[model samples]
Target: MNLYRELAKEQPYFVLSDMQASMGMDAEAKRYMSENIRSEWFLGMILFNTRLLHRAIAKGVVFAAALTRSPDDPPRTKIQFVATREKALELLEQWRAQADGGRG
Candidate 1:
């Protein structure tokens, strides 16, 4: 199953699908992050029920088509998409460093 991980001090975060728009817990999911999680420079990619991808994007979060039903991206979108846990962390680190200023 997928999971949500908001790295401490990391500018980006990965929030698994079930955690965002599963049938019975959608509100709970958003609340968990909107309220519980706090950060100024956080880039968050929230996973939603495969079906919720379209709608979720309408809500604010950007969805790279490559991340829809699978954990891996094909090729073209891969450059714009960050799917794996490690890559997400790396992206976040880049964001964090940039936000801190001086060097990224």
Candidate 2:
């Protein structure tokens, strides 16, 4: 969470997380992180090579592709999950394009 707070200082950044070698987190940690996440901190995040349970959890959070917010609404971070680095990069490019007013 500290790392995320630090990263939040750079508001418009994106994250590409490789979770293949991760040991996984407990329910308490997951709840803590999710509840504490500041949606306005980052543009989007991609989690690649995640386990099945992680993928399910991610899907339950919010899908980047389905995000739709009015200018008057509060910010919501976009999150996506993929199986490969290539797919992750591809999705990140799409998010960048959207962020840049479709110019990316």
Candidate 3:
């Protein structure tokens, strides 16, 4: 299993993954999120294709940003899961939205 410490720079939520890459697959996304994320504020995984492009979302640090390449598969340099980086930031934003009372 892969270990991703934090999800964002100011958020508390984090993501984890067992697969090296998501490639837009839902199952891989789930696996990655299930393996790494271990926080209460953490949300579900954001499965994507490439890590090199999405690395910025994590803020540069592999452990800090996102887990590039899976621990299960070293040859591959892809990421599978994604979530919030900060808990306070997420809660505050969510709270604000709720207060605003937007609808789907």
Candidate 4:
């Protein structure tokens, strides 16, 4: 989280997270992290090589984002789950293009 805060000091950035070897988070930790994430500086994130359970949890987070975010606020972090690194990179490129106003 410190790293994220430091990076946010510069500019909004996207994260390509490789979760293949991750031990996965519990509900409490997930809630804490989600509550702490500042949408103003988090552009988006792609989780690649995640386990099936993690993918399902990611989907829930996406749903929560849609429900909790206000229409008046700037875009929140867009989270995506992919099976492979190549696909993750492809999606990241698309996100970059979108963030760049289609200039990327």
Ten contiguous residues minimizing lDDT sum, candidate 1 = 73-82
State which candidate has the highest TM-score: 4
TM-score of each: 0.33, 0.65, 0.22, 0.69
What number of backbone clashes does candidate 3 have, counting pairs of residues 3 or more apart or in separate chains?
13
lDDT of each: 0.40, 0.74, 0.41, 0.77
lDDT of 1 by residue, 1-96 (tens): 112233434434433333323456576665554443322222444333335443553243333332342446332211123345456566656655
Report the lDDT tens digits of candidate 4 across residue range 16-62. 87876566556687677666766566678799988887778666766
- Off-target runs (Cα >4 Å) in candidate 1 are 1-55, 58-81
* Quality of model 3 by C-alpha lDDT: 0.41
Worst 10 residues of 4 by lDDT: 33-42
Candidates 2 and 3: which is better by lDDT? 2
Clashes of each: 2, 0, 13, 0
**Candidate 3 TM-score, true structure as reference:** 0.22
lDDT, candidate 4, at 48: 90
Candidate 4: regions farther than 4 A off: 24-35, 59-71
